[model samples]
Target: MEGRIAAKAEQDGAVAAPRRAPSQQRSRERVERMLAAASALIAEQGSDAMRMGEVAERAGVSIGSLYQFFPDKRAIVWALAERRTAEGQACIAAALKDVGDAEGLRQAFSGLVDIYYGLFLAEPVMRDIWSGTQADKALRELELADSRANAEFLVAALKRLRPKADPAELEATALLVWQMGEAAMRLAISVDREEGDRLVAAYKRMALRELGDG
Candidate 1:
């Protein structure tokens, strides 16, 4: 439910900044094509094996045009990750809108898990992208920042679900929920599809139990 998007800031030996963002409609469309091409390549081959030239060729844009939006492969991956994160957040926010109690939270969590499972299944390259963030310290910081944003969103949802709960405890609980949910999702995707569904169901029950849901 977290670990997406980045500020493209200088941190811990990572790139000092992101490439210039597309300013005009045509440039934006080209950037979209480049990112789309990169994603397709990453899905077909691991990110490490993908090349900028290949992406540009697949996108039908000049290599120079691709570089105009993403200076390197990492930038391409980062932008893709950012797009995925934004999508994940939107899904969670929409799910939360209908959640009103522990039972609602349980159902919403099940849906959330399903969404993530589908996301990973559909875009296998995201698994590698996530792993890369762990090996790179600066990307890990970006991930933490992304997680914090998601944590705040979780906290807001929890407040709506259990308004009588202590604010401090809710904050801590929200963080735990996010971490545990993320771990569960990773595990779920690592197993067979049917087994993954079972795992997600079990996690939903366990997580709801932790929140005092009967």
Candidate 2:
């Protein structure tokens, strides 16, 4: 009887294990659908127009399923913001790779700014989310952390550029650079493409000069 019971338990475990894969896959697919729907809705009507029902309908899922994946619209927006932030961080990392010393730092800084500017320009929704009502306190905190990470990246590049600079001064300079770049990108979005390009170029030059590289 003990052996039979053990055999039955093993059989139940095997049955449960097979079910787990499809269950997890279904969950992931549902979440992906929700995210895709949210992105489309936000792009078409802005965040204000995004309703959970609309997301569910667009994703071809029921409202209950939508809630299962995301608690509310804010949760959806937060997930989107996190995705965009990760993409930006990856781009910055790629741009800085193989970069050496201060002069390399200057080039890396300019490249990083250009990549980020292009990213935001390509995805205006991201800018709208950042500057619009979609931004809540939680999202704002996330943005602050993201900004700090970018600043730290700049600091690392700067240290390579100016190995002799004081640590505190290097950190301060990195923070300034990060802020300046962010402001430049925000301003660029309002102007004509040519003007925006010029603005970014000017900002890059100013940043380089500030770092004493120009």
Evaluate all candidate structures by whole-model CA lDDT and list the values in order: 0.74, 0.71
Worst 10 residues of 1 by lDDT: 1-10
Instruction: Name the TM-score of candidate 1.
Output: 0.87
Residue 24 CA displacement from its true place in model 2, Å: 2.3
- Could you estimate the TM-score for every candidate? 0.87, 0.81
**Which whole-number lDDT from 0 to 100 does residue 94 have in model 1?**
83
Candidate number achieving the greatest lDDT relative to the actual structure = 1
lDDT of 1 at 3: 24
| lDDT per residue as tens, model 1, 127-169 | 7777576676655666666566666777787888777888888
- Measured with C-alpha atoms, the lDDT of residue 97 in candidate 2 is 64
Error of 1 at 46 (Å): 1.0
Please identify model 2 stretches exceeding 4 Å from their true place: 1-23, 133-135
Stretch of 10 with least lDDT, candidate 2: 13-22
* Candidate 2 backbone collisions, by pair: 102-161
lDDT of 2 at 67: 76
